[model samples]
Target: MFGSLGLPELLILLAIVVLIFGVNKLPKLGKGLGEGIRNFKSSVRTEEKTASDENGQDATKDANNT
Candidate 1:
């Protein structure tokens, strides 16, 4: 439901976007948005992997100390 935006609100937003950008540009816009989201997800995953590796080392150190 997009937080506060319902289905009707989404339809209105879509109509406004179509009016502003036209139907022809929608495909390219969608493609660019998809690529941006994909890249962001990949970078976040890489960061999580690095953080987990550091955490694993810390855990090993703590175990040895005990």
Candidate 2:
């Protein structure tokens, strides 16, 4: 639904964010956001790997039982 945002909309959103957070805190905000996103991505990857490994083990167990 939000896919239609263009340059003006982005600029206005940025302006609002700047007004809310102030320029001095922007760097810290960006750093925290980056770190949070990185942590989230890493956790998602770990979960996916664990799930795949479990599925593989289950399949092997089923084959041995047959």
Clash totals for all candidate models? 0, 0
lDDT of 2 by residue, 1-66 (tens): 679999899999999999999999999999999999999999999999999999999999999999
Q: Give the best candidate by TM-score.
A: 2
RMSD (CA, Å), each prediction: 1.7, 0.8
Please write out the lDDT profile of model 1 over residues 1-66, one tens digit for every residue: 479998899999999999999999999999999999999999999999999999999999999999
TM-score of each: 0.83, 0.95
Worst 10 residues of 2 by lDDT: 1-10
TM-score of 1: 0.83
List per-prediction Cα lDDT, in the order shown. Answer: 0.98, 0.98
On a 0 to 100 scale, what is the lDDT of residue 61 in model 1?
A: 100
Q: Quote the positional error of residue 60 for candidate 2 in Å.
A: 0.4
| Model 2 whole-model lDDT (C-alpha atoms) | 0.98
